[model samples]
Target chain A: GIQVEQSPPDLILQEGANSTLRCNFSDSVNNLQWFHQNPWGQLINLFYIPSGTKQNGRLSATTVATERYSLLYISSSQTTDSGVYFCAVESRNSGNTPLVFGKGTRLSVIA
Target chain B: GAGVSQSPRYKVAKRGQDVALRCDPISGHVSLFWYQQALGQGPEFLTYFQNEAQLDKSGLPSDRFFAERPEGSVSTLKIQRTQQEDSAVYLCASSRRQGNTEAFFGQGTRLTVV
Candidate 1:
């Protein structure tokens, strides 16, 4: 099974600040996604970037498949952005295997 | 239509008792997955289903855990002889295809085995 590791286990940022979260995987993956678990426990899909970069409003993500790493960026952070950000991956060799998740980066944006 | 929906937003069961959780994936979705997340921990895979077939269940923690998706749409996860260690949030997610793809998750059922 592949292992996913997230960095900056905890982060606190003021409104309008910018921050970056990272995820590293132990093996090559065919699928990679970033999710935001809101305060109410809804896991919102943020990005599905197996490779390259993608942006959605104030959030963006980049996955370097060759390096086995991915990054999530938040610009002009808001109180609404406070929650847990998770990175999950599914390995190519593992057929129909569920996605492996990282411990996650807990972000708190204070207004 | 709705995204993945889970019933019994929360459940409290006595030790050694059995519990069942339900999940309704998005309409027309072909794949479903179940995961467990302990407090302050990341979600761990429990099982996966492609349509009505359970293709992988290697992540199930023990024999006490079982899941089913007989109609390829609605799914259920049952835990037998529950223990305190089984207390966690049970999350259900679904994707459109069988291979690698984006998954939509439900709000999850928070179960507490007392």
Candidate 2:
């Protein structure tokens, strides 16, 4: 099994501020996804970046597969962005294996 | 449906009781997954099915948890003799492909065992 580690266990940011969260994995991965679990317990998909970079509105993600790391960036954040951010991945050995998730980065964007 | 749907958004069960959570994945999706999320924690993998066949269940915490997707479209997660430790949100997700696509998730079933 691969080990996923997310940095900045907790973060508090003022609305309109920019922030970045990181995820490091112990092994190579074929699939990587970023998810946002809002205050209401609904998990929203943010990105499915296995490699390279992708931008969606104020949120963007970059995965450097060779480095076994992924980065998520949020700009001009809003209070609605407050929630737990998770990074999950599946390795090359994944056959029927489900995604392995990191502990998560708890973000609180205060209005 | 446009997205995955889960039934009985919330449930409160007495210890030793059994509970079943249901999930309806999007049409044409081939992969379905069940995950358990404890308070203040990320979702943990429980089991996975590729269509109607359960491919892996290595993440199931114990024998008390079982899941099935007989028709390959809807799935159910059943926990028998529930314990307090089993209290958590059960999440269901489905992807268009088996292991290489984005997974759409349901809101999840919140279970509280007393």
Candidate 3:
């Protein structure tokens, strides 16, 4: 089984600030996604970057497949961004594998 | 539906009781997944179904937990003789493809076993 680890388990930032979250996986992955869990417990899809970079609004993500790591960046964050951000991946070496998630980075954007 | 939809957004059950949670995935989705998330923790995979076939259930915690997708569009996760430890948010997700693709998740069912 592949191990997914996220860094900065807890993060607090003032509104309008920028932040970066990191996720490291122990093995090769065929699919990787970033999700933001809102206060209502809805997992909102942020990005689907198995590899390469993508940007949507104030959020962006980059995955280095060869290095087995992914980075999510949030710029000019707002108070509504407070919640948990998760990185999940599906191992490429496995057969019919489900996404494995890291403990996640709890983010708090304060005004 | 525009996205994955889960039924009974919240549920409470006494110990030893049985409960069933339902999930209606996006139409035409080829893959469906069930995950369990404890408070302040990320979701953990429980099972994977590809077109009505349960492929990997290795993540299921115990034999008491069962899931099925008979028609490939709807899925149900049933827990029998539930214990307090079974209290958690059960999340369902669906993807358009089987191996590699982006997944959309439902709001999830928060289950509390007393």
Per-candidate clashes come to: 0, 0, 0
Model 3 clash pairs are none
Deviation (Å) of A88 in candidate 3: 0.4
Q: For every candidate, what is the interface RMSD in angstroms?
A: 0.8, 0.8, 0.6
Candidate 1 — which residues are off by over 4 angstroms?
none
What is the lDDT for A8 in model 3? 92
- Residue lDDT tens for model 3, A1-107: 99999999999999999999999999999999999999999999999999999999999999999999999999999999999999999999987788999999999
Number of clashes in model 2? 0
**Against the true structure, what is each candidate's TM-score?**
0.97, 0.98, 0.98
Off by over 4 Å in 3: none
lDDT of 2 by residue, B34-99 (tens): 999999988999999989999889889999999999999999999999999999999999999877
Full ranking by lDDT: 3, 1, 2
- Overall lDDT per candidate, in order of appearance: 0.94, 0.94, 0.95
User: What tens digits encode model 2's per-residue C-alpha lDDT throughout A1-111?
Assistant: 889999999999999999999999988887899999999899999999989999999999999999999999999999999999999998877455678899999999998
Clashing residue pairs, backbone N/CA/C < 3 A, model 1: none
Q: Which stretches of candidate 2 lie over 4 Å from their true place?
A: none
Q: Answer with 2 or 3, whichever has the higher DockQ.
A: 3
Q: Candidate 2: deviation at residue B3, Å?
A: 0.5
Identify the leading candidate in terms of lDDT.
3
